[model samples]
Target: MSRGFKKFSKNSYKFFLLIYKTYKLTKKFHEFDRIFKKLYNLLNFVVFSVFLGVGYGKYCIK
Candidate 1:
């Protein structure tokens, strides 16, 4: 008997939700120019931060 949460799907449900939200927002809104731009910038920052953090950790460990 196991405990805690189990992610049985290859793609977690949250990923699906994120994809759906992004798709819907982009498809439905033409005037959400600034909002979409800000969201894109925020996503870029998160991705860059993850890469930078991992690279710095590897350098420190070596």
Candidate 2:
């Protein structure tokens, strides 16, 4: 009946999952230093892209 997708919740869910994975990995293994950095970088990229997309949608599209 309604759209299942909303940008805030969807992106925030991705955020939550990234945080959870980072927590779990840190809790389990010190060897995950490289992997943890990768996830952190990925989270930065995701958030950046979301903001960029929002701006593009608002300003560049009709």
Scored by lDDT, the top model is: 2
lDDT of each: 0.59, 0.70
RMSD of 1: 7.3
TM-score, per-candidate, Cα-based: 0.49, 0.49
lDDT for each residue of candidate 2 in 1-62, tens digit (9 for 90 to 100)? 11333566577768877876777766566556567668867977887788778778888898
lDDT of 1: 0.59
What C-alpha lDDT does candidate 2 achieve relative to the native structure? 0.70
The count of residue-pair clashes in candidate 2 stands at: 0
Please give the distance, in angstroms, between residue 57's alpha carbon in candidate 2 and its true position after superposition. Answer: 0.5
